[model samples]
Target: MSDILFSLPVEQQITPCLTLCKKDELPVIVINHPKAKGAISLQGAHVLSWQPEGEKPVLWLSPESNFKQGVAIRGGIPICWPWFGKAGDPMHGFARNQLWQLIAHDENDECVWLTFSLEDNEQTRILWPHSFSLIARIKMGETCEIELESHGDYSFTSALHTYLNIGDIDQISVSGLGPNYLDKVVGGEHTTADKKLTFSGLIDRIYTQPESFSVIADPANQRSIEIHHKNASDAVAWNPGAEVAKGMADMPDDGYKTMVCVETAYVTNARTVTNDKPQFLSATIRCHKNEQK
Candidate 1:
């Protein structure tokens, strides 16, 4: 592979080494940072996140397991390798903490592929001990797509969490989780078939076998975000509520009232991929304008 370098448009450099793409009449901003990876932006228009740079990306979506945000899928949107969140091992994995280099750009198609490697590192070898190449490509067009491809010698756990912007959490309800659900926070064994799925209090649960799911109508923006996932076996939902949000240094107390994550993934010793055959998992969230008819 050739060494590739990406140049940022002057207008965006003041914020970060970012690039913008406008295609299919949609706009996207790609932030090229060593510690942060993946697409970070708002739909319909670009919006900045509350999280500071040089830290793990506030936005996450993955093909592994939904552990973090963008939905609540578990372990978050982190690539947990060697050991997921163990002592000496980085919080999630090196993927989110390492700076990704821009490998290629497709202006006509409106796409950018960013790549990161762990093949030549002593620190990573000590931790992961695997030779691999991870590429996260953000494509803007009719559908905003984020593709994570891994090529190497190990299997890992991952998540694609999405913090969806909705009119009001109180006005929303999720559908399609079949009969019972498993709660991972308490223990992986407890089950619930009693309560209808509603968001009001502190919630952190991994659900499975849903008929289908969606966010309720948003009167604030007259738009709702619809999510879809593939190659995933589970889902997660979360909100910090009041007390938890206050304790969190990363989240604002009021932030919980505006965003809710509905993640798509497989979590906690669910699956693994290796050198012989690499596997993939992904999720997509699309914003639909709830026009007045």
Candidate 2:
């Protein structure tokens, strides 16, 4: 685990809020800066929490989620690469289950940034059988940014699957996803949404032609979350209904009421990456008071 996870110099590690510790069997790095606070799990290199100063958390984490390797922790941003969902073995690709190398970390008065890397090895070869280097870069502070960079001579599908925390799931509405989408909830049927999406029970749709940015209006929290996408043409809106949510071991029976996943995706098809042409996708999530919108 020491080789897989990184620790800064003694001076940096001695900060009041920075931590490199093991949570159960998982190696996690916790942040407690004045501008923001969060936790990053080395298992899958997944972000388990991110909350900017004086506001609700931008990422939702299930209290029941396990903090161990091989299990996908339910929250923050999970990198789904080489494949999304059940399209490939291990469900959402091998990248999320492997230990990632912490390549860089830096901070300033306003924000903190951490970058992780994962290169193809014998382990990943068992899954997609591709040669590549994947990067998960994160910025935390006034706003949080997640970037996924892939370099290799193989094609892959990937996403920054972000689960946002809201005061109440029913009181939120998501807008800026273009009118049409592939309704995965209804077995991948094509549908049109003429208005902002308001969740009732379950909502799982792959929206097409989404604007570069979208808003998650949370009336209960008296704030709105802005999600920005880059280098990708698709976005996914999903929430497991009560029934399904109750069945997931990682989530509480009612966990679906406080979370929603809006994934910035390049998962419509496998994207080709040549030695000279790497692929990149990102999502930036920011929050502000409702009145400011």
Candidate 3:
């Protein structure tokens, strides 16, 4: 249906390597072994606007405020789990920037698939000290899906931090959190979120055992992205609130008007994968042209 370019821009970089390619015709950008720790951007992908000029590009991942070592932003369809910001691993895990190689790229005149993988590196070990392999695959179509598999170690935890752009936060609400949840910020106690998790105050919550939940509606796009996940038992919603927004190095004062982070994870007390099994995390996002405003 579409002539997707399944190739990354090839060039040399001083830090590590920056590859910009297209998949199923959609721009797919990736970075390898990024040092000095910069940012990565893909064309048309919704990036976080931290300044008036939007310098930050809403990095698909970020380090947690406290644990500045792990990954945070899983750009595009930010998928976060495992740690779920419960630990001190920054925003999530460190798979985003750990030198991924283009393992497979194929186009059979119909659809395209682009896969990238990152094995345990000396640099990463210094920070995480875990032996593992992380793979990220991006496929294009009416609906795009990215699948992450933790194939090496079983005792691992992580998440996909998707920064969704929405209209007035007041107009949005997330459903499927069902009834009860454990609030990590308030006191690691259980509470009831029977209705949609509304946004109003400095809301930071982690929900467990979600049946099914779609991301908040986007008034600008006039269409909502339905988020579906499997194997992940934890979900987190975060907004810097007001006070933290002012002190942010990359977020604008009014930036709060447009975006929020919906992270999917396996956080509680951390999860370990045994039996040589691959822990899987995936997100499927389909955009509706008919719903476009």
Best by lDDT: 2
Residue-level lDDT tens digits of model 1 in 128-245 = 6777766555543333445556667655665555566555667766654445456644656445564445677687776666444444345565665555666666666776677776
TM-score of each: 0.66, 0.92, 0.70
lDDT tens per residue, model 3, 105-159: 5433323445766777786677666777667775543344567777666476666
What's the CA error at residue 265 for candidate 1, in Å?
1.4
Q: Which parts of model 3 are misplaced by more than 4 Å? A: 1-86, 89-91, 107-111, 288-293
Model 2, 104: alpha-carbon shift in Å? 1.2
**Each prediction's Cα lDDT score?**
0.48, 0.82, 0.51
Model 2 residue 291 lDDT score: 76
Residues forming the 10-long window of minimal summed lDDT in candidate 2: 1-10
Per-residue alpha-carbon lDDT of candidate 2 for residues 1-293, written as tens digits (9 for 90 to 100): 12222333222363466677676777777777889888787777788888788886778888787777787878778888889988978888877788898878888898888888998888778777778888889888888888888898987888889998888888898988888688876676475656698888888888878899989999888989999999987899999979999789989999999899988997776789999998999889999896745
Query: Positional deviation of 157 in candidate 2, in angstroms?
Result: 0.5
Superposition error at 78 for model 3 (Å): 5.1
Judged by lDDT against the true structure, how good is candidate 2?
0.82
Off by over 4 Å in 2: 1-17
